[model samples]
Target: MKRIFTFGVLAVALASTVVLLAGCGGGGEEETAAIGAVKVPFWHAMGGPLGDALDELVLEFNATHPEIEVESISMGRYQALSQKIMAAVAAGEPPVLAQAYEAWTGELIENGSAEPLQGFFDGPDGLSEEDLADFVPGMLDNNTWDGVVYSFPFNKSVRALYLNKNLFEAEGLTRAPATWREYEDMARRLTKDTDGDGEIDQWGTAGQISAWMFENLLIQNGGQILTDDGKHAAFARSEGVEALEFMVRLLTKYGKVTSGYEYQNDFQAGKVGMIEGSTVSLSFMEGKYTFDMAVAPLPAGKQKGCFVAGTNVVIFAEAKQQEKEAAWKFIKWFTSPDVTARWAAKTGYVPVRMSAIESEAMAARLDEVEGLREVLAQLEFASYEPRSAAWYAGRKHLEEGAVEGALRQILTPKEALQGSAEAVEAEFLGVVPM
Candidate 1:
């Protein structure tokens, strides 16, 4: 689940209105017991079945915890959620809890709009060490900043290769490719003009120009996005160039470029042999495709690497103490082993807690969905993207400037990536004073 937006616009809008945070301060706690339960407003971007799954959990929480009433507000999409969050924060009236990507969390933290969760983590009702250890390490790391916890992972997902079993069978590919070389070979074999019309009716694979996919390839090829101090770009090296080149090769020779979830749609329609997308994509495809489909871990590049996507939930500092406590309770309940397992089963998002993978819900789901076990296994080696707010705009530059430029044959891989790197460096410099 990748989110698209131009952070430069949000940052510029925020800079002019950030001083409002100092003027309109946090509200005092009201005696809610005298009247009713404390209200916690949660803003999110989950839509369709994902929204349904989230709403079910919210209803369950509200019914089970009589002292708290959570209002789940859907912003419809990520771009709107990001814009609204910025507008609300600027006006000093942000929601009590909200879904935020790492970049948004970083911006909120820098502006003193996000609450540090370490105090809650060590509070009387805090999670024990055992509970903390149960979560995937990468998930925890994604929500942490400056050695402190600022948010908790929610709806986290890893990229997966969805295979059209019929296509693979026809091509005599018994198993999913385990390496990039094998993948290319399989792609070459799977692409075909089935009707003898001299036009490729069935493509080997299809995808959009995605920075997330590029990041996965970059890391698999042993490249890091930023240098050690998180201050400079390091992805314009040979590893990145090689990654971009591979994407261009596939698109040009064996696959096709698509927009949004068109690749997933094409795969479901049996027009594509394979497609690279998030694990959550399964939820969208369920009951829609007629072909025998299977999910696989992404084809490895030199070594295995996967990037975790999706957003985390954060409690705003402007909320009342009671509302903050209520929000924390909801966060804890939502991420519990059984709850997370059920969420995974319902939404096709990977469970954040390791124990959830072994839960009965996940086991039942694995039985229903082919190759889900392999997809979930990717968490062991998965990593996250850069947490700096600058990466938001920087990622757009990668997709539009580097990935698209190289794919469109407008620039060589090295030239495209180097230009994106310079632009990202400038963004980092621009946000230093903020």
Candidate 2:
């Protein structure tokens, strides 16, 4: 889940830095059209093919729009982008637009650094009711806070279970598991010591200690990360314990524990039979391996649940009015049905709009990709993590303290979760004035 971003230190750093730009103005906005092409600088952490796809879209946008030019600046990784954004905001010179995680958007909103986008959405050149209805509700909801739209979902992805189909066929398994029970049974059966060296080389499944994965399992078991009031932690309860215990059983009894992207490498190398990964991972594994693969919705627990992942596009309040206008125009254009569909088709990301999912571009992609249709179908039940800035640190605590502690046998699941809950509660108290 800590793909290209690590937030533990950056989250704390951003809290102190973002507030420094409060009440800062973007200066006068008189007759700026005479200055030629209002430049809107966009800071992002998209590299590799993802970055290439985004740059292509930006080029297309610039080529068609003579009056507005968007400068897409690559920050290489989210951690560096986050640090640079905080430093820029503190210096009163933030970019016009940036890709922001939910927690970062929350921090920016709290400090008055983010421009509330609802106004633009309701403006003269705004989206129509039909245009608004095109977006996937959950994806749109992720960008709205306190009943106000503050950003727009960008490069969104959902967790999907990736299965090594060749291995499945070897075991005479016809399809992916439909339930946690079936998943566990298949994991047990798929694990093997092919060389007979008394050491198992092939695992049924593998995963890193991930708060993202844990969040999906928690929701599947009817648990929430925070209380309904959104003021305290709720993951120490029975539901959470059950979720962690299941993960522990999978790693210790049936699978192996990994760190960072080792699980992904293992899965690709055919050393692991299955893995829970982002839909975007398909782009990374497309033609690298010889084995047949399949992607499916995460196996159900007590109920169906999937947590949406990735950042959103937010415009800064400190940018000039003209720059902000240009940023909005680009955001609007980029998220349109056809544009989003094209982005998803080229990058393996899920389109934020339902119309985009049904568009010809995505339909062609689905026909070409093996398991993408099922992956996109997960959007129907997808939800997002807490938008509270406290969760930026809270998730790190969950992964390192609760998840790792339990997986390493250093603490019982209950004890590990209780510790994480107490830590997150402390963060909420520190970040928000109770």
Candidate 3:
């Protein structure tokens, strides 16, 4: 909420330092037949309060800039955005910027649909080498490919367990779980069908069981999900089987939670005692239910892990010079220490800049929640989703593959994991490393 951007209106004076300037120059570029206006389209996936906040940000951008115009269109989450983008590109109208996941970002750059923005570091008043150091360590590496940073991380979310404090207290549970075994022990105590209807009326833990979530949990349990190269699947190993067996035990043995209810809805409605989801869940959850809510870090395994989740800013390859410059200016403010501090405080996505997270504002906000301090502490051990085309093109198959083994009582945990791993391996048959 703090305006760290000073309105000096300094023109981009230096050119060569500007790394990705395919078409840049302040007043030196050729003028179009149109007068003093450039249209830059953006596609983003956000809804509810955070979406409203983004709309306000777009208005702020429009109000401040005279030469460039930004239009942020809503494209739903991963599934919806991918469909919309594919259709738009086929129709010859891709947006200037996109809000996509790390997997999608990798595919965009691989398909020549996106360009690296690292040159922004060298441009006139672009991100400095020191500025680069201010960023949260794992963010850029998550979105980068082949030695180049492809996406500019704007907002980030990480895995966290949103526990219903009232429920925990009612069940004599005083604290959140720190390790997988602890989580399992607590979940069993919390699961009970109060009505004796033979069906579960309450659950101790819930989440969408998929490959990525599998990777998140498995890695937490001392497992390696992807190969060293980041292109191949490595889930068929002992580590992978151990991870799947752990989750399968949750559904089959513990009976903590069912998969039918939407993750946030059930959590917010009070039927769910514990749910793991994006930190952005806080935005929708503001003032919803007045219960003692506290956040716990994603439970750790011997390996220690949580996936970095968020959107990044990207400039198109042939965008207008004025548009690119304007975008960079907004990005500078968006990613700055003070601005990101306020943003993380308002929206719940952890700031991707280390300085922003440490700023006094964030510290004060943490003092208020106090419980979230552990989540911030978990940043030191976060991991990235494996970047790949198969991940983008065929994540659902993996999801179904995982959910199948997890929900059914028929397959042993090892059997489920082996089948799921084989399925993912089949999908990665011909991926050439970049």
Candidate 4:
């Protein structure tokens, strides 16, 4: 991880070019009472409605707290934001707060780029017991490392099946499939060559195959990504093979899914029946689709499952005490039930705190949204992706192998997954289970 983050002089110079002064406050016990307003620069990857919602929150926070202001910076996408964060950290000028993926949290911690937030959690001005209890189970704990909390959940999301009800009705289906086999059967039935050209005009389902998707299927099939001890890769077992084979068979046998963004575009265009996608799609699909859309929990295999996504806010250790305090204030306010609920309602992200979901305001908002209830229900079965420094490297194997085995048919599912496991073992760890 350090090797990947070691920027050359040119990279450092480039990072310097991107630096901007964030805040106006100064710190010292003597000057504490007279401290000026602090401006916190927050780097985030969200765009569209999600970004708008974040900006709204920042505006509200700034209005209420005259002593602190938040400046939201858009970094395009998560990948671009992540790369910029690394470069910024290497340049010793990280934002006081930035959004981070779970795997990125591991990297940041390992590189000493992030500050452990346990002190804030346990401090006098920290979260109250009632506040602590408000968070959904595992949501807050997912950000903890070695018993220390290091991050706070921001725009979290889980997988949900987006169904076009008009298309389902055309197929004589009244509801979404409840099991894997049923889903596969429906996928085949819904696939169509409407123009008599023998070319598929409508697909039943489509989603990018990545480690997050693989992990969802693996867990749904009663398989784990790693052993209990977390020392070795364990997704090469029979259950894992079943998961891999099922996804590959969708393309090779049923020929339902299209490659790349075409599937999503098709779904938006009302040419696709259903899509396995994140709840965040709600924001993306708003006011644009031609069909009546509904969402349902993912189909079950050995068990119901899906992967949670979105990033968390992590403060930088390199920040001054005043800035850190100001950043913490923003983090706390952002995660508070009322504020978090407002954000979740405006965007499609899940509310981290249960109290937020149960709030009267949130209840009213959920009643207005078409598919949000189903998304919240999925939280019961969703799990966070693995947090590991090696995840960045190991993840590439699955992403590439998914294309090789599923779409291109260059290898069998087992061979592709096995090759991925072996590559992860050789490159990231020593010996994964075969």
Candidate 5:
């Protein structure tokens, strides 16, 4: 949906030190397969159930394709993994395949640390036309920048509204909120002081004022994060203020929501009636909540909109021909319709392929899963994160703006946004706002 508001905008790893370094300094337009079993070092940030699911897929792939062996390594988290990868790249040693975000992809591209996948895709051993057509509409496109595809979607997830069905039923609300006003009203209704204490014991919702959440709100408020040329900030306008205003009001005015990561714990403990989080959280949340949990698309503001996040698989430019070939093979196998469908089912990520999502297998799997359908449905209205390297710095400024307005109350929403705009423009575009 097109945003309805005015001027608003939106928005690792480390591994084996020695072995990683030993596999460096080789690159070519075309990859050649090795005769023996080729070990592809793959780095990812997923842990717990998601990590287990990834390992299982690698095992399955290796079992079927004996010539290709994938060595999957959990790098703790995305930030840590990213730093380690960059260090490895600087040392002329990097993994054969690794999970990365668009921001990272932008950096890697600029540094010539990542390989463009366009050639591979158009090559003889590439995905067939039918296979390419099977991908979710925007999934593949999201990985492309400047007509070159540098990565493929992996472990992508969309933000979803998680509702406490029991609380909603108690309030006589049979369905999730559909708009901003409805969400506010429901939030107010759900908030309570159960023990008659002066302080409220339960909150209507918990909010995370991150760049991604801000971007979703900004777009929903009918604003764009950057100008058409992608050289200036555009989100500090009226629409931006309105978006931030809405977010701030939820906490400062209505007292419907609390800030911080504690919301997840609160939601599970039944102290918060609603929480918006990634689809991947479902794997960690399963059997953890005490109440009947339900998922729904984010409530629309002027229109329905969302932002999809998570990493994409990128082959380091330093990888050898054989390893590169093996990496692409693993990438292809991992993102295949059936494979991605099973991955989604097991790891709580949204499947990247339309064919997989609509397949009978996915249908059956969704039936067994509680909230998978709602998360998948969000793809229809989602947008990709900013693909420019500028976004890496811009995101921090955006987060600061949100914090100033929503948490600290140090600045009005408009002031916060304007300050953020100026900071981002100066830092990234090297322009000072007048």
Candidate 6:
């Protein structure tokens, strides 16, 4: 998956706020713990309900190993977490472990902050292979960099299509759009100016247009961000162009797509018939909507699908031997079947563990929401985006480039992706192979 694409390409490799990174630093009120133990501090970005889950997870782990006490701390969202990590590094008080995005790990690795888990992950009790044996193949790949694995999968997510079932019926659409072409057609049909005035009252779609979302569309159209080995920009080609172009068309051609937050507001108002969003967003929507709402697999593309996001658990190099061991143990328990199922059920973050997914409880959960089942089905065909240290910064370039193309309609897909690729390439300072 992502690791292969990155490793294959570069011989290399190579987050969000709380709640934004549901498995990140958001909670845990440590009333008190054992007096003498290998104390381990883990900083993450999970918050609210999800944070509660991670705190509970720590309590579960502590029940058995009293000697290894893990203190889970919430450090805020992606940007905030990034700042906290940097400040901690500066103060030389970095935590023992961190639940970070791939890019954050890259920055840590470059700064000599993250410890390479090569030996441990590859060793006899390596969680990479043993603990994750039940996890998705892609999660294992995503954890790898060049050849070294620096982290393990925690909770993960993807861009999913949420359809207001009532709207679907109102439009006489038999099924959700199978692809963006269908997506486009349905969007226009679903859009209406409910009032007599000539302004759009209902929109067919709306969603954040970050590089992650663009990756979804680009890969779907058969384009890749970089050469498999991470050698060059692959987006200047057809798939990338095709994907972004579709968005531009959605905005300018269809007038149905608008970039907005409060996706629920629009959808609940019956102003948005179809919307694209994260799988984790389902928990909030599940109980609120009166109209039937459904979660659909990210629409298919020529190349297939890629999960939009997920965070990783990376232990810092600064950790003492005991703390590192303790951190690894927490990672193992987190991905374990019973643990993974409970987290996924409560938070809606997909379980990376295969065993957890196969459990009877999970089967029953799937039966409850056939829509989410579609998201799970993608697991067989799912691939992670090319995981690279550069991807963190690279995504920003892709974001700006896509927004420019879509909103301003300034560049064709080719020009837009080429510009983005070039921007990414420029960051690497070295001679290029002829």
Best by TM-score: 1
Predicted structure with the largest lDDT when compared to the true one: 1
Residue 254 CA displacement from its true place in model 2, Å: 1.7
TM-score of each: 0.90, 0.89, 0.83, 0.87, 0.87, 0.84
Per-residue CA lDDT of candidate 3, range 1-434, in tens?
13333322222334434634644332122232135557667778877677777766666666566566566667657579878876766675677777777776665676676657777767776787788887888777776777788788877887788899988899999999888888888888777787999987778776655455676776776766667865555665677677777777764555433454365677777877887767777777778776788888877777668777667877655556666666666677678888788778878988878888778979888887747878877778787766676655445655676556555656666666667667667777786544
Q: Which pairs of residues collide in candidate 1?
A: none
Q: Rank the candidates by lDDT, best first.
A: 1, 2, 5, 4, 6, 3
Model 6 TM-score, all chains together: 0.84
Q: Give the TM-score of candidate 1.
A: 0.90
Residues 169-244 of candidate 2 have per-residue lDDT tens digits of 9999999998889989999999999999999999999988888888899998888888888778898899999999
lDDT of 5 by residue, 1-434 (tens): 35633223331123454556656523220133235788898888988899888887887787778788788888989889999999998899898899998878878888898898888878877988898888877888888878889999998999888888898898899998899999888888888888997888878887666677778888998999888777788888898889888877776544443456667878888888888888887887888987888888888999888888888999999998888988898888888889998898777799989888987768886886556686688888788766676766787888966555555678888888888888888766553221
Error of 5 at 386 (Å): 1.3
lDDT values, one for every candidate: 0.88, 0.87, 0.71, 0.79, 0.80, 0.74
Candidate number that wins on lDDT, 3 or 5: 5
Considering summed lDDT, which 10 consecutive residues are worst modelled in model 6?
Answer: 11-20
**Model 2 RMSD to the real structure?**
9.9
Q: Ten consecutive residues with minimal summed lDDT in candidate 4?
A: 21-30
Residue 220 of candidate 4: its Cα lDDT?
Answer: 96
Candidate 6 whole-model C-alpha lDDT, 0 to 1: 0.74
What's the candidate order when arranged by decreasing TM-score? Answer: 1, 2, 5, 4, 6, 3
What TM-score, to 2 decimals, does candidate 3 have? Answer: 0.83
Clashes of 3: 4
Clashing pairs in 4: none
Q: Model 1, 317-434: lDDT tens per residue? A: 9999999999999999999999999999999999999999999989999998788898899899988888777778778888899998987889999999999999988978857622
Stretches of candidate 5 exceeding 4 Å from the true structure: 1-36, 253-260, 369-371, 430-434
Error of 2 at 73 (Å): 1.2
